[model samples]
Target chain A: MSVNILLFKITLLFYSVATVLYLVDVVRRKEKAGKTGKAARWILVGGFALHCATLLARYLEAGYTPVANLHESLSFFAWTLVGIFLLFDIRYRMTVLGAFSCPLAVILMLIGSTAPTAMKELNPALDSWWFPVHVTLAFLGNAVFTVAFVAGVMYLLQERMLKSKKFSALYYRLPSLDVLDSINYKCLSFGFPLMTMGIISGAVWANSAWGGYWRWDPKETWALITWFLYAALLHGRLTVGWRGRRAAIFAIIGFLCLLFTFLGVNLLLSDLHSFKAMEGP
Target chain B: MMNIIVVGLSHKTAPVEIRERVAFAPTDMGRPLHEMRALPAVAEGIIVSTCNRVELYAGTHAPEACVGQLKAFLAAYHGIPAEQLEEHLYDYQGEEAIRHVFRVSSSLDSMVIGEPQILGQIKTAYGYAAEHKTVGSVLNRFLHKAFSVAKRVRTETDIASNAVSVSFAAVELARKIFGSLDGKKVMLIGAGEMCELAARHFLNNGAASVMVTNRTLERAVKLAEEFQGQAVPFEEFPQRLHQVDIVLTSTGAPNFILGQEKMEEVIRQRKNKPMFLIDIAVPRDIDPKVNKIDNIYLYDVDDLQGVVQANLKERQKEAKKAEVIIDQEIGQFSRWLENRDVVPTIVALRKKFEEIRQGELRKTFSNLKDLGPKERQAIEALTAAIVNKMLHPPTSVLKQNQETASGSDYVDAVRTLFDLEIAQEEDDSELS
Candidate 1:
């Protein structure tokens, strides 16, 4: 295999190991072994680094942006997930968010490895700087929602554990529900603007490339759905005073839509964007 | 079999006066525990002492002997006669006793349902019993299982969520107003329990500073120290109220403490800043008319009650989901227990029939010494089938009967009838 494929394979291994370690930490209720969650974070960071290197190498080899295909988008999505998680940790000092985000990153990376190697050649209409900017911002924005989803899930789990009065092994290790809820809100706050920018840029790119700004393509439609859901969540929180579990649930559902857009639409359903289809090793 | 019984009064069945009469102080538990254990029918005993209720759980061969002894012990402990104690005490025996332990551990029996304090109290009782050597395998297993079941209930149910007390509700209400308390200022008026609780909540939420003022300076200082806040003099209340974003006033004062004029002046000085004033005192500390101010949100005891009621309603709604989860968890645990009950019999039956087949095979091999290897193998297969056919019915009967109450009797009967007693003893030895 080539250097890009080799690095991609190694990143997959790193993610699988990280998932195993985190799962063990959750199941065993070991706060000490949760320190291994830090090791998993580092492995993810390494994976993210290799992932970036592979993307860069593929971009250089193909003489265009590597994210023009479904497999490439998945790889980029995984890379951006770690990027967003690192940003969250720096801003909120919330390293515990890794337990959720890392597995998601691994899933995206595993999906990325299946992209057919011969399909790196971009279609004639895809050759522009706006393509990279629009897709990059979109990837980063979705990554933020991914983090929000993780926080939302943790919030629900922690809330349930607390409400039931079962201070079990998982409960003590989890961040407080309030903290998770706040982080969920924060991720959406950071994400919504990036997503707006991505959507606007995608519209501009599409107008220049395809003669119309909105084709309601599967990717575009799903992106709009994701944007609308988050937009409603933000509006509800600010206007309706929707706080805590409701907000978390909305965030989680929005991310699910985002996941479907990234993985499901491109893989399960063939579309005009089928050139982005990923193939397994 | 001798049964362990638990009988007593709780906050529900009896008034505080009667509960107090039977209540065992933690320091006083050891003496009654010894007295109960020494009774003719009592073999072992444990005393669970709490502020709301006191219970004596005793294991004894004579269940009726435990009743009179418990009544006598309560009478002696409280300096009352047995007849006076009899009116207050309720009794539970056998399965009811086990159910009571489960209920108590799960906090369903707590004065506040889902309060976390009961589990710790139950564990403490277990520890005390272990220390006094009053617990044996049966009671030990029973209580341990109760603890596990309690844990399961908590994990699988939403019984613990949003069941906020007055103090916590005050805090939660304050949080909804202030998005984040990271740098908010709070003024706690008086050193009452409500004030202390509100102060702790603010401090926990990252309040920048808390100024506690009371009619007495010493009490204020002590309450402030507990929460790592500052204690200001009562005279500074009006001046400090302007500076703080949130004011929690809970005092023993018999009348309205804050006049309309004073609060209006403070609000004017604060330049229309949003302020949350919680009046938790009985006679109402903050002037109710101050609620007229644009940004002044005044909540008296009634308002707090409303909030508490709403939170309880929300909890009740979520509780349905939690109940379903708890029921699922219980089902899972029951399945595991059911599987555990049948495991030994299954192993015993399988081992017994396998042994019979091996014995028949050896006898066949001795009888067929002249047979070739291929012919001998075919004979062995037929011999094994014959042994299996003969044992299948009885062995399956044993397996099927394993979950019933009479399962052990069946095992014993099989051991006697087939001389499987030697095999059982050998298995027992292997287990040991």
Candidate 2:
């Protein structure tokens, strides 16, 4: 196997181990199990380092950004998700969140690994500097939205437990509603702006490369729809005080729309931005 | 086997009159703690006195004798008759004693389940005992374990997460809405007793300032002065509503005072910042329809009471989980205590065997004046082998039984059969 493949495997192994440890700590719910959470966080950091190495090695071998294929883009997406989650873990000190998020990262990596790992040449249309800027901002926004999605799910679960007056193990392991809500708000505030910039940058790149700023491509249309959904969530939260259950439900919906825009438009629908290099000629 | 004992009266077992009488003053704790440690059987002692309970936790070699002495000490300390105190006092020993301390420290046994004060009270009690030099190694380890167990229960269970009183529930709701009250403003309308109490709860929780408004200008000024707040005329309060984040109203008005239309205008003027309105009046000063308005939340007396009741029920459920945690910790501590007995028994048994071996060797050596040095060493080795061969079975049995319920019984049987006299002072050093 190549060095990049070896690094990818090592990253996957560490992420899997961290996920198991986090799950065990969440299940045991004992004070002694706290060490497991700390260990899991350190292991995740190691995995993130290896994941960065894998990306760097791939970039060197491909002679262009490696995100021209589905596998590379998914791997990059998972890396960004883990990066954002680590920032939250440090700020909030909620280790149980790892139990919720690390598995999602692992799943994304697993899906990414299943795709073809062969390097592909970038399309001539994608060789502009705007390519990297637009893709990075888009993935970073998705990563923030992913954290918000997890927090939203946790908020709904915690709210159900509190409202039903059932103090289950999950209830104790999850943070309070206030904490979860604040985290959701923080993610939205950060993600929404980045998303706006990504769309604007995409428009500029399209204008430069395609001779027009507007496109009726499937991907472009879905991206607009996803942007509008998040814009409405942010606007309602600021002006109409949409929060708690309403905010949580909207965040989950917005994430689904984002997922469809990112994956569904690329795989199922014909689009101008499909990165045809992934189609194996 | 019951080395730890807890003797006390709490709100559950005694009335406030009796609890107050038995409670030890902090300034006077030194004499009582000293007297408790001075008791013959008590190796270590701590006296925990609070408004809700007065408990004496002691570590001792003789559980029964120590309990008797503590009972008498309590009678003598307060000059209360032994019979009267006996009716109110309760005692727990052995595993029961350890579990009681764990539960008490975790606030499972508080008058209001999950109240946070009892843990601090116990910590203060332990502090006094340490300062008086009454707590030895055994109690030092046990109390620290209790503290960690309490912390685990707090983090691993939602026992103390919710507010169980009306005033506290209001504060909790405010926190839920605003996340933090550091710079939040509070306004009090008409100054009913319950409203003032809830306002004080908000202030204690970190509200920046309070504003008071009543029908009578002098009364509003007086109430505001007491709270170190600003006084506004009752009629002008609505015009200034945008300045406050929380509004508590409890007036004698027969109808809704703060209606939906007025609140909608205020919400618009405030730029839709979230507002919490607690209508504590019987007729409800704030209109119920206002609850549908965006950025406005209103809870009346019944609503707060409903929250309190639900929170109380949640605490009761969490208490069961806390008890399970205590049981697990007690099992661990009890194993340690049992292992403590095994060491001394094994030491004493080994000492007895060695003594016999040495005595026989001395006799052989005296009779063999003409014997060679090699010959003397051979006889010494043979005698040592005999002792070891005889001790191997029983020593293995004792070691294997250390964690079982019958471990202490086996330890006592061995001590009695061998006529072992293990010095108590020697074991004290072993613990350290």
Candidate 3:
């Protein structure tokens, strides 16, 4: 009912339209599909800019960073994903990633709106600046990993077609396996450090707030699992020379773990981070 | 008259075992072509040798005689019974054969339709034959046309889409794991071919550094130099595995090299950061139990195969769409070939009728000497119309026959019966 909520809803609508255009482009393989892809990207960017305005307006209206509750966290996470995608576009000029990343952003935004929006008491730990820092870094890491996941999926699909010797229009439309793999690796390289810093910051925050730095909480465990998966990917590249599809699979699994950590831990189980699930399904 | 016929087993009709038996490795292609050309009726020849196929493109003056000679040549070359291979041999003559070569060079006839490798293979074979002086005017024209068709196919269709091979698949999986690999350290624990492929994928993906450890330091060093990675002692592999985020092992080891206990220690040293392990070796090098470690993610051969199989299925689906494009190209090429045979006969027939009309015009002018020049011109035009009307039916028939399989033969028959050859000879003599 609020202006911010309305704008957020509008962003989702635009994103949905973008997803359709991309899918049509991929299937029909028409030259006009490229034009559609460009239009979708521009619309997504417009929606993202509007979404940023909504977040800022909400911050002014609510008297706090909008990353406090489950809905707010999801919104912030989606915002970071678009931010990362824009950054990728600047460097790689990969328009197709908008097709995958935009839909993901839309899904997250939709899920975000459904979460309970009632103002709740902020715990002492939440009052600290470190809370925002940790959450923001972790989300950014996840956002970067999400892009990597998309690239990895494309890479696998492309590689398979190549191996099977099946050359088609879709195959040509998709980025080369080499390009996707490199992009995935680049995303992970950037993501892994952010995630590591987030985890470390979270650990320090936990130690300051609760007198324990490391706990075997479900969220923490899953985050560790995801981090380990990425770590293995990094190590495999250095020591074992694991580079292409093998590396891509690991990156995908890592992002999946990250998704589990972000959403699954909050929805499926109870832990120290249970309070964070105020908006989760 | 000559015909170029290509009939043999390829990767499509024959398995590797069968294809290899008949495959003339690049080195053997020259001698085989020379030997096949020495047979009766053979005029010129070229051999296409690739991992998936072995086809002999032969232009012979006597096609029927050369078919037997080609069969015998294959039988003797591979020691396979001629009858056993006869079922796979498909023969095409003249224009049909030319179309076949163009389709093949363009990858329209490939097992994995639209693959680009066949074009290069065709080019290489053609180049070799040219060097040997084995392919002359007719074959030269055909081969050049084939190259042009290949270029056209690539330009016209979206056949070169997001294709990836097994080597790159490993790199893609890595990217999925780490998100970005710009400054990531990778450990390659073997110097096997699969490892080299994976390493190349990594280098392509922006992995900043790579280290290879192998028992045979020579092979390790060799592969390392090629991939811009370092080679370390095999025994120290576990020590480096902890520092790096990814491990790809494809060694020729007999036993497991990386155990769970070893990985657990490595994880501790990594401060519980994630680690990805890929063992592409047979008699697997990395222990499967390592997958149970808190921060270790291990993938064996079967796991990679699962990804490979899934990717292959997706490609197969795309291939179906590509086939439609190839079929359309084939139809267009056939139509063009059909149209080419009709133009010459149509030109000759028009000239013959014009000669008759001109001869009648001269006779009429001689008999009516008092008529004005304008009247004479008018009379000549009227006579020309009559000749054109009389010739219309046969010309239409000739045009219709041009599209049929017997079109060329019909044109030849018409030319001989009308004494068009003699007329052409006399015209040439007059011009000279």
lDDT by residue for model 1 over B285-391, one digit each (tens)?
A: 87788876544667787777765675566446545554544454344433323323334545656677788778877887888788899997887788778777877
lDDT of 1 by residue, A46-76 (tens): 7778777888888877777777676677888
| Cα-based lDDT at residue B15, candidate 3 | 83
What DockQ results for candidate 3? 0.04
Off by over 4 Å in 1: A1-281, B76-79, B173-184, B189-193, B204-208, B213-245, B250-300, B311-432
Q: Chain A vs. true chain A, TM-score per candidate?
A: 0.90, 0.96, 0.92
Model 2 TM-score (2 dp): 0.74
- Tens digits of per-residue lDDT for model 2, B136-178: 7568878988988898898878798777889998887776567
Better of 1 and 2 by DockQ: 2
Q: Where does model 3 sit among the CAPRI classes? A: incorrect
Alpha-carbon local distance difference test for all models: 0.72, 0.85, 0.74
Per-candidate DockQ values are 0.05, 0.27, 0.04
At residue A51, candidate 1 shows an lDDT of 76
Error of 3 at A192 (Å): 18
Residues A1-281 of candidate 3: C-alpha lDDT, one tens digit per residue:
88778877887787788778766666655323467777877877887888899888777777667777788888889989998998998887666677678778878988887887665656655566777788889999999999999888887776665444344555546765557867877987899999999999999888887789999899899988888889988988777666666777887888888888988888889888876532233
- Per model, the share of native interface contacts recovered reads 0.00, 0.19, 0.00
